[model samples]
Target: MSSADQSHPSGNKPLGKRARQKIERPRAILAAALDEFMLKGFWAARVEDIAAKVGITKGTVYFYFDTKEKLFAETIRSFSPNLASESEPIDKNRPVREQLTTYLAVLYEAVAINPDAKRVFHLLISEGRHFPELLDQYFAEFLAPALDRITSLITSGIERGELKSTGLASSPEVLIGPAIVANLWGIVFADRHPRDIDAILTTSLDLFFRGLLE
Candidate 1:
């Protein structure tokens, strides 16, 4: 049967002929590929496997993405939020405590909602040496800018006299590094309720603030 004959599990009707034959084909392939990669890991996942999962031919998969790496890159790219780009414009006039609280809250919520993405991220960080391009794309697109934002926030806080001058400009790592590690730990190991995430974030902010406060 053609991909059009396949019924979606969502109880929705099948896509129209044009959509199924055109738009839905690539999208469905990507969705299935994401599931496969998340479950199987990037290196282990195969194009044929994704094609099989999507009920499409391997040629169809190749039509959309040239290789497994391209598919994985697209999958990771799809998961990115507008928050990263928007974060730079955050109001520096806000009180440092309030700013930190908002920052931590946003980070916590982002990770909590996308647990699979967090898992994939952890895996990539741990085993990404095998795929240097994947590592480069992941860091250049996501991690480095994120670190820059945190460093900027800390610098602003110090300028406002809200935080002690630890000379974060020269050692940006010292201010936000622990929180990055903490966030990864929370993503990988913590099983706290979603509602309780705020409390946990608040506690982390408190500890961070105590150390940084003037």
Candidate 2:
């Protein structure tokens, strides 16, 4: 190949292999780290094994993440749904009950039904005490944002007089508590005893709406 051809490579293609690898390596590391963490849990998981899974050395992993704790935290952050961006669309024109049901259903799908979310939740429950800072990070980045969205929905409903002044808007944790319990049930029980999750959520939502509706 001529020097010009060599320099331009695929002509319009802007990135070279080295440059592309630099962009992709961190993602690759995070994916491998998540798998390793899920398999071995935090204390038992080894950075070298994660590196081997990515076909890189331990030093290279450290070069990117600097520490296993950092890698674990980043893995959770990486897989976490950006609730701010992925939040369910709420139509103000719709009945508040319908809007809330739709919103909670979407939240349940993301937090309970998603396999990655379950694994991350298990990590938090099992290892969070050892890493309080990471737990705080998870709350700040993931849970807090989701709860804030739910609070906004409830607050709007109350202001519009569609929902009763039941104090649910101020304590959004009450809204999500069932979801957290359901997710924990899945983690602890697995398929040993399966529950009809949808039916349960529907019944629960009906009772909740009855109390909240004006």
Candidate 3:
């Protein structure tokens, strides 16, 4: 029988016993795999290791993901929501600074809560030489949409005269890029020092607002 044909003690919920098992197995595997991958990294992480971590056989791991590359790709995809969700649309009628502040706060909270996920993300970015396709998928699926939304916000701010009439088309990058870099640096290097995140965000917004004011 296929893996989906197996039975589980978990109650039925539209999926057959085997299908539910199949659905749940990968989630369990991915949860364990993420922990292992974050601890050991993509190149060093082995399917056997992940299988042991998830109490499954190596063949079972392959059945779910087909390859280590696919597993890592999925792992990276998982981290992305933490970052991408920060860019959800804000009320356009809200004050520009308030909207920007909310965006930065969401980004900060996501990183703060998911440090391991962030570390895995950084590793992917730094060591993705052989996996350009994976990196491309990450950017296309997560980062690009977030950036587009931010850019749209900036454009709207300009059009509404809430921002300066500067010819800067990539205003979102100008506003957000430095903050992202700072957050990454702080997380990776600051030894978990008490950063006044509110102060930093306020200062950044102030600076951006000053530049954009008439």
Best by TM-score: 2
User: How well does candidate 2 score on lDDT at residue 203?
Assistant: 74
- How do the candidates rank by TM-score, highest first? 2, 3, 1
Ranking by lDDT: 2, 3, 1
Determine which window of 10 residues in candidate 1 has minimal summed lDDT: 192-201
How big is the positional error of residue 103 in model 1, measured in Å on the Cα after superposition?
2.2
Please report how far candidate 1 places residue 1 from its true position, in Å.
Answer: 28
Give the alpha carbon lDDT tens digit for every residue of 104-129 in model 3.
55654444335655555566656688
- Candidate 1 residue pairs that clash: none
lDDT of predicted model 1: 0.67
Please report, in order, the local distance difference test score of every candidate based on alpha carbons.
Answer: 0.67, 0.80, 0.68
- lDDT tens string, model 1, 144-212? 666677777777777888878766545654544544555576655676622344555567667767778
Which of candidates 1 and 3 is the stronger one according to TM-score? 3
Each candidate: RMSD = 6.3, 5.0, 5.3
> Candidate 2, residue 158: CA error in Å?
2.6
Best by lDDT: 2
What value does the lDDT take at residue 155 in candidate 1? 77
- Candidate with more favorable, higher lDDT: 1 or 2: 2
In model 1, the Cα lDDT at residue 86 comes to 42
